[model samples]
Target: MLLIRNLIYWLLVAIVTPLFFLGLFIGAPLPRRTRHVIGESWARLLTWLLWHVVGLRYRVIGAENIVKEPAIICAKHQSGWETLALQEIFPSQVFVAKKELLWIPFFGWGLALTNPITINRSDRANANRLMLEQGTNRKQHGFWISVFPEGTRTRPGVAGKYKLGAARMAKQLDMPLVPVAHNAGEFWPRNAFLKHPGEITLVIGPAIYPRDDVGPEAMTRQAEAWIEARQREIGGVGPFAHPDERKARTA
Candidate 1:
């Protein structure tokens, strides 16, 4: 049954993605707000497909922690799920993604239209410079920036080293840093075919205001502690789980 549902979900993607891409071109030459609305609409459609086609549901805890004003959203990277869900959750936000993603055909063009902060991950120094430079400009224009501190998707029960780019951008811009933790990979394993039907819990922590004396590394450490602790509380299989054991569970 799960396999059938997953097939249906991908079928839906195949049908809808091209249409969304066409809409992107139509919205081109219009204002950035117009393109953003189109992108948000596509995200909402995909989120709905995830629920109806795949039987996956989600609930956001501490949504009130999400302020209306522009701030940095630091979220866990697990599956492709958050990429769609976050767009629906936070409207008119820019994501910090890799430069390679911008080279894709239709999806990449749409992403570029949204004015995301694309970085070449290979060059650490240049990436930081771009994040600080472009991130500040985006924030000044009242756009929220969503960054994945781990940089790439990590399997459930695994935690990646938290990067300090988001923290630095927050401090540089003097914005509130909102940390997010979720176990989405438990249901939607990275690079896996089957997506189990389950209610994913996304917890948003309180805004951490960076102090003048506090540096990015320190601020990131503080956020990392809270996020990792919260991950365990929300049913993350800790590092103690063996690789084979984890694989069997996913299988």
Candidate 2:
């Protein structure tokens, strides 16, 4: 049953994705924000199809916590589901995605139209510089920046290292950092062909504004603590700890 549903969903996706790509190109001459509207519409459509066709639904907790101003979002990376769903969850936003995504065929071209902060992960210094430079510009243009601090998807019940990039961007820009938590991995596990039918709970933590006295590492720890705690409550398996603490234990 799950396999059949997933097949149907992907078939529909194969039909819809390219059509949206055409829309993206047609809107390419428009302003970045306008192009983002078309892109987000594509994401929203896929999210709707996921619920109706794949039987995987999601509910957002603390929607009120989403701030009015353009802020930085530090979200857990668990599955591709969040990639689509975050477009619906937040306002006009740009993602901090890897530069490799730009090389993909249709999807990459559409993603480029959204004005994401693309970074080459191998060059840490360059990635940070690009993020700060482009992130400031995006925020000034009223686009929230969403960063998956883990850099890539992690399995359900597993905790990935929360990098300081997002926190650093937020601190440098004096913007708010919002941490997000969800159990999307349980239903839509990474690299899994079939998605399980279930309800995914996504929690949006209150905004953590940057302080002159605090550094990115501390802010990153705070975000990680809140996100991981919520993960355990929602459905994640146990023994979550910060990367530093885990290292300290071994040392």
Candidate 3:
């Protein structure tokens, strides 16, 4: 049954959706918003398909606090699920990710159309410079840019260090920093082929603004601490809790 669901979903998704996008790109008079709407629907449809295929479901909390702002999203990157899910929920999203992801087959081409803020992961100084550049550009373009401050996906119950990139962008752009947290790893963890049946909660807190007196270090710490607390409230240990894992029981 699961295999059947996966097959049908991917057959339509992998073949039909891109073909539709291609058709629209060629001669169709579809507006950019229309294309984005179709992409959003596709994300939700696939998410539902995958859930039913594996009998997995999830919930979100405090999503109301997220406003449509020209701001930076300091998200906790745990598993790749929330990235697509967030963009689906908010179609005007401008994702600032490592430029390496541009190599993905279908997705790479799609993002180029919207012109996302891609950064070179190879050069540290260069990447930071590029981050600020793209952040400012996305702001001017009126796209809400999301930055995963953790830099990389966290192991279940293990939070990675918060980088200064997100804060720097917020300061440079003078935009509020919206903090997003999700307990996705318990269900769709990093490098796991078999997705498990569980509830994944995406809890988005309100935007955190930089104080007139504080520096980047202060902004990073506050955003990191808030998300970490939210993660703990959802039943797992805080991101800092590497406190001796008991073999990580797959949820």
Best by TM-score: 2
Who is ahead in TM-score, 2 or 3?
2
Q: How much lDDT does each candidate structure score? A: 0.84, 0.88, 0.71
- Global fold similarity of model 3 (TM-score): 0.81
- Residues 148-221, candidate 2, lDDT per residue (tens digit)? 99989997668899899999999988899999999888788778778878888899999999998999999999
Q: Is candidate 1 or candidate 2 better by TM-score?
A: 2
Q: Which residue segments of model 1 deviate by more than 4 Å? A: 236-251
Candidate 1 residue lDDT tens string, 87-189: 8777478999899998998778888988799999789878778788998888877889999999899876678999998899999888889999887887787
| Overall local distance difference test of candidate 1 | 0.84
How well does candidate 2 score on lDDT at residue 177?
A: 97
Stretches of candidate 3 off by over 4 Å are 1-12, 20-35, 236-251
Cα lDDT, model 2, residue 227:
97
Which pairs of residues clash in candidate 3, taking residues 3 or more apart in a chain or in different chains?
Answer: 159-239
The top-ranked prediction according to lDDT is 2
- lDDT for model 2: 0.88
Ten residues in sequence with the least summed lDDT for candidate 2: 236-245
